[model samples]
Target: MSRAQNETYLLPFDNRIEINPALAGLNKNSSYQTGNQYHFVNSEQTYNLFYASWDSYSNKLKGGVALNFSQGMLSGQNISTSAIGFYYSGFPIKINNSRILLSAGTEVLAATKHWAVAFLNNVIPHDNDAPIEQGESFFRYYIFKPKFGFLWTNNSLQIGITSTVLHTRDVAFSLIEPTTTLGYTLYVSKKVDKRVRDLYSRPFEMSPELVVFYREEATIARLRLLAEYTDKTWGAFVQNDFTNHISTLGGTIGYRHNFMRFNLNAGMGIPGISDYNSFMCELSLNIIVPPFSHSKYNPWAPAKN
Candidate 1:
């Protein structure tokens, strides 16, 4: 069965803004809600995102690292937590005309016993590899989630594909290898080069998108749709827990200017088919350098100084 990265702490980061299409619209602010999977990572648009990765997010950086932070569907079950780990790229990278993305991640979940003993015999059960502190939950989970991506960027439109494992570390545990999530994630969205902005003004461009991901083995895995609409202000339209937890609607507001990306996401839990949930605002800034966009205005243009 597909497993989820119990790092519920990063739920907050999921509400933040992003450039990777796979993660862009699925947040708390938006009407889209997802299983307890970790969908957040460091700013990919930046030139130096290497520091905010798994082992590094907690070990090398030394600074605090967060993964997710969101309130669950149950009343009185408010959730706010973060972890030191890393996920994979939810987007594709283009080179000359080719695209490449490494779909993988590794981490040890600090889960309690209830979720641990269920599949205890199979996994290594700690003690080696990395030295974790004592008293810490042995629910340390690892994942080798693989992903597939497609990218096509010309002068008119930008589109792509991204998939994340529902849970890599699942089923039978191994004596040697680490574990990860099981299910898989797929993202199909398009960004058309609309009317020229006052220089890429938020009001001038339009990027509409759709999102869906699921896994049957993983009871928590479900399919959902998300669309990013922008005319003046960007709005992320979403549907959560469509597998069985229906009625949970979500949405987010976004705005972008040149090199800066901003976002605000809100999520609510559904009763009956869902759980009692409310809203939590999320904020984030992403710095991205277009792989093909030039910076000197015109590489061949003469200077006016």
Candidate 2:
């Protein structure tokens, strides 16, 4: 099965910047994040992907900037893909009580296809009538991708839309193959039991989010329900592919201490009439420098007294 270079199903929260450049400095403080995903497609096929990023809000620039790196490899394929991205977003425009921002970014990517020495030695005939001509055993190519997006935010609601061109060549010819995503976040609150409140320093909060990704080949959608208490978080999500009619189910647990937050996520393909076993797992970490010390620093501002 073919996978998108930026697919991060099980850990979307940790990889938001990869999905939308407008979110590069969306947080209130500078932050760092890194993660990896392991996809076990079947008994014989597997894929691994890794990424790291750092982003900071710049008061002087009145916006934010970010740097990110990611790589992916397949178990049986001799090909690997890697990319480095630089992103920026300008200051928000206030509308009533809400705010909105626009962002733009680009990435340089290198995709490599190579033949292993052992494979070349075993497969290439040396003495036969059909001796192959020896040439370079590897091919490497580079591509430039450009993207732009916007985000709108309020105390309880967030919506972002982003569009990216996969190839500079296509853009030059006006034949762009664009990938786009629409993401939403909603925060909810409920009265807490006094006993429950006493056990934790902060009140519990819940948010349900929905995100849709559109590509030339398919459209995928995910819905997630998340809860947080103090610095702990738990979440569950269901993802669906509209074109392929495939579904996945997953959950995540995370904790934050000091400047670091760690998370683990696991998911599996949902079987229909026929039983199937496809699994994906991911581990992620985030560090927010100069962690929020006051309520105003929260990503979602609280209502004033």
lDDT of 2 at 217: 44
Model number with the top lDDT: 2
Off by over 4 Å in 1: 1-140, 144-181, 192-202, 216-232, 255-258, 269-281, 291-305
For each candidate, give its TM-score against the true structure: 0.46, 0.74
Q: What digit string (tens of lDDT, one per residue) describes model 1 on residues 93-160? A: 55785444332333332223333332443365666433222223433343333333334543434444
For all candidates, the clash counts are 43, 0
Q: Write the per-residue lDDT of candidate 2 for residues 44-108, one digit (tens) a residue.
A: 55667799988888867778898989887645444466889999987679999978888888888
Give the CA lDDT, 0 to 100, for residue 39 in model 2. Answer: 71
